[model samples]
Each structure stands twice: as structure tokens, then as C-alpha cells.
Target: MDFLSTYKGGLLVISHDLPLLDESITSVLAVEHGTLEPFRGNYSYFLAERERRREQRIRERKHQDEKIARLEEGIRRFKGKTEKMAKRARSWETRVEKLKAQRTEISRRGRQVAVRFPQPPPSGRTPIKAQGLAKAFGQNVVFVDVDVDIDRGERMIIMGLNGAGKTTLLRILAGVEHADIGEVELGHQVSLGYYAQEHEQIRAGDSVLDHMRTVSALPDRELRSILGHFLLADKVDQDAGTLSGGEKTKLALAQVAVGAHNVLLLDEPTNNLDPQAKEALLDALEQYEGTLILVSHDTDFVEELAPDRAILMPDGATAYFDESMLDLVALA
Candidate 1:
């Protein structure tokens, strides 16, 4: 934020990071309901002004509706009387029609993104157990002698500094990548769902609907219905590679949601989400009756999810989650 505020060049930042916008931005160009509108202040100012405008429009619309209703009522009562009364009724009808035509469309408040995870099937008490897990790339050892035991219906967070192998660990648990020396076992009736931070699972050259098909064998109608909940229904035919970062995040989450898996391995799941979407995801995860192993740098998300346990990386130490561990999460 400091650097962006200090830079002399023309700046156009497209981000959901509210604090960054509040500190660095001087104006906002909002694209809402297929219209581009500019506000001459920061994001906070734009939110306030936008709400004020919506409220004003709603008030005006209510007044217009009342006026039209009254005119219609007058027309109904006067049209059955004498010729002059009928003429008056006709005039009222004309006024009602004109008022209806001139009524401005009220801008709707933004809808919150719906992110509901389906209840997964039951698994054994200990859904996952990893022993002596280790990974490395060339000379840089990510972690060694790591052990993990995730109980069913438990939430566990992975915390570490950047490059401390948080994401790598999650990928290993998800079976997307192999550990250098260890074995990960799933207990009886356990299924896995993985949400990759980079969205590498979403294939290029495929439409949004196509990706859903790969992850789930449900009918197209059902798949589109799931996509609709994630606000991606309209983008069904759009190429997955062309989606924005936030859209990709939604797609990846949607993919995870449809598997009906008993365990979830999530890496930075909250990365590109807007505030409302993030809140919705938090609410959904809070209600999910499944084991979760999460790797995230989002402090508020980690705190809100309130994982039952935490696995610190590099050294791969296990500990019951406490308030003190939040500091390490913040640093991540």
C-alpha cells in the first residue's frame, strides 16, 4: 500500500483486499450489474455512497408506486359514473400509465455469494494418518519427520512462514503430490476433496461446465445448479482459463464441494475471495461435518474456523491450537 500510494504512475488496482484499497486508492471504478460507474473516493467511500444511492432510489420507487396505485383506485371508482366522471377516470389512467413508464429501476443491493458445502458421508474416527512424511526440492528441504493424525469431523490448520512447505504438505495429503519418504493412509469410508490455491486442477481450453463434469458425474442440469450457487451459472460456456482470480477461486471451491468427500485438504482457500464470499465460505465450513486440513495465510479465516489442532511446518510440530498460534498464522 505504501509503495502504491507513493508511485507516480497511473495506478489501476483490481483487488478484493479492502485494507489495501482503503490505504492506497484515491478513487473507485465499480462495475456493478453490467454497468461501469466511477466514484471519486476510496473503496469505503464508494460503499457508503453506493448504499445511499440505492436507498434514495428505493424511496423514490416506493413513492412512485403509491402514486400509481392511488390513480388506479380513482380510475376504478370514477369510470362507472357520468361522462365527465368517465373523462376524469381516463385522465387518471393516463397519469398512472405515464408514472409507471417514468419509474426508474432501483439498483439492487449486492447479493451475498452462496457457498454451502454438502454434508459428507460418515468416516471412521481417525480418518487420516500420515507417518514420517518428508519432502524437498533439490537442496532445499521443505520438512522432515512429519506425522499427522486427523480425526473425523476435526478441523486442523497448517501454519508456517512463506516457503515453509504448508502448501506442499497439503498437496501431499491430498495425494496430488508424493512425499519424499512417508505414507498417508485414509481410514474406512474416507474420501478426499482438495482445493488447490493455484487452481492447477482447472483445465485450460475447457468451458466452466466442462470442469464441473470432470469433478462430478452428476447430470448437466445438476452441475449447472451447483455452479449457480457459486455465481458461475452464467459463465458455464466461458473458458475456464479466462476467468478472473476470484472466479477461479470460486470454481476451485465449487469443485471441492461437489465431491461429497469426508475429508478436505484446502490450501489458501480464501485467497481471492471478496469479503462477503469469504464470510459465506467461513459459514459453510463451520457447518461442514467433515475432517479438514487447511493451509492458509488468511488470519481472520484461520481464527474463525477455529481448528481443533495445528501443525507447524518445517519442523512439523503438532500442538493443540491456542491463541498464541494465531501470531504464526498472521506471519504466514
Candidate 2:
């Protein structure tokens, strides 16, 4: 923000950080209905003006709807009554058609998923522990000598750059990929749930409904109700491979919810989610009582999670989380 504020050049920053937008931006260019509309102020000002415009559009739509209704009624009452009456009715019908063609649709708010994780069964005080975990892919060594322990209900975030082995570390811990050396040990009665950013857990041949059923034994009615909350009720029968990126993300989360796992390993869980869905996921995670170890590039998400500890990759350094670590989280 300081750099952007001082730079004497035009800048385009794409971010969801409200504070950053408020502090750094002079104007906002919003994409609405496939067009970029400029608002000459910060994010807050832009939001207020956008809401005002939306309300005005809605009022106009209502007025147009009433006019169209009256025109249709006039046409129905006059048609086939007499030649002149029929001609007047035709004119009214033409006017109605024109108005309908020119009518503007009211902008719709983005849909938000009602995400809720199932209550996980009780687990031991320390649900997960790693001792000198190491991983290397051929010539490239990602991380080595990493040791960490996760207590019950603790939230931990793994931070690093793009190739900093964040995802690799998560995969190793989840047992999706084997570490080159060392091991990740699970405590007693720990049910683990892994959410992969690549959607590797979702089988291509299975339907969304089938995936949910594989994770849980919930009845059809209950399962469908849960799917409805994630806006997947209509797509239950669709092949999981055919779903959009966002749809796949939602399905993966749905699988996690049904698993009732006490330990969650999430790798870039916020990837491909729109603003509303991201908020929904964040809200759900905030309420979750399970042990969480996550890899995320979204600083806002990490901030909201309020992780108690952080594991930095490459060198595999573990440290208590503080505001200073947020800079590395942002870079991640």
C-alpha cells in the first residue's frame, strides 16, 4: 500500500483485501454485465454507489413491468372487438414489445453457500505429529527436517512461495503423497479429511451424489438437503469431471462435511471460489471444532482463521504465528 501510494504511475491491483483497496486505490473499475464501469473513489465509495445504481435499476424495472402489464391487459380487452379496436390493440402490443426489448434487468446478488462441517468424533489431545519430515522431487528438494505437532482443535497454516513445498507438505501429511523421509503420525481415534486443491480426491467417473455417498452413509433426503445448501442439488446426477471449477470445489467441501473428520488437511482450499463462496467457506471453517492444517495463499483467510502456529517451507521452520508472519502469508 505504501509503495502504491507513493508510485507516480497508473496501477491495477486485483485483490479482495478491503483495507488495501481502501488505503491504496483512488478509483475502482468494476466489471458489471461484461463491462468495466469506473467509480472515482475507493472500494467503500464504489460499493455505496453500486448499491444506489442497483436500487435505481430495480425501480425502473418495476415501473416497466407495470406498464407492460397494463399494455397486455389493453390488448386483451380490445382485440377482436372491432377493426379499429383491434388496430389500437396491435399498436399497444407493439409498444409493449419495444419496451420489453429495452428493459434492463436488475443485477442479482451472488449466491452464498451455507457450508457446515459435520461434528467430528472426539480425538486425542494431539491429533497429528510429524518428526523430521522431508521430501524431494528428483533434483529439487522442497523441504527437510520439519517437525510439528497439532493439538486437538488447533488451526495451523503452512506458508511459503509458489514452489515452497506448501502443497507437497500437505500431501505428505495427508498420505496422498509419500515423503522422501520421516513420517506423519496420527493420534488415537483421529478421522482425517483431506481437501486437495487439484480436486484429485474427486473421481472422474463418479457423480457428485455418488462421491458424497462414498464418504457418508447419510440418507438420500438428508444428503440432497446438504447439497442444496452448496447449490449442487440440481447437479447431483452430473458427472463430477464435467462440473465447473467452482462446482468441483463445492463438491470437495461437501465431501469434507460428510466425512465427520477430526483432523482436516486443506491444500489451497480457497482456490477457484468466488467472493461469496470464499466467505461461506471461511465462516464454516471459523465454526469448525476440528484440528485444521491448511495451505492458503489468501491472507484474509489466514487472518480470519487466526492460526496459532505457522510452518514455513523449504527450510521447514516452525514458529508461533504473529502479525509479522502475515507478510510471508501474503507472498504465499
Estimate every model's Cα lDDT from 0 to 1: 0.90, 0.88
Q: Compute each candidate's TM-score over C-alphas.
A: 0.86, 0.78
Q: Against the true structure, candidate 2 has what lDDT?
A: 0.88
Task: Give the TM-score comparing model 1 with the true structure, all chains together.
Answer: 0.86
**What are the per-residue Cα lDDT tens digits for candidate 2 across 1-332?**
67887999989987766777899899999976677889999999999999988899999999999999999999999999999999999999889999999998876785569999877888999998989888888888888898878899998989889998888888888888888889889899999999998999788988989998998899988889899999898999999999988889999998988888998899888877767888999999999999999998788878888898998887778888988888898885
User: Which residue pairs of candidate 1 clash?
Assistant: none
Per-residue lDDT tens digits for candidate 1, residues 1-332, read: 56888999989999887778898999999998888989999999999998888888899999999889888988989998999999999988888888999997976667678998899889999999999999989999989999999888999999999999988988888888899999999899999999988889888899999999998999999999989999998999999999988899999999889898889899899888998899999999999999999998877788888999999998889899988888899886
Best by TM-score: 1
Backbone clashes in each candidate structure, one number apiece? Answer: 0, 0
Report the lDDT of model 1 for residue 133.
95
Error of 2 at 147 (Å): 0.7
After superposition on all C-alphas, the RMSD of every candidate to the true structure, in Å, is 2.9, 4.5
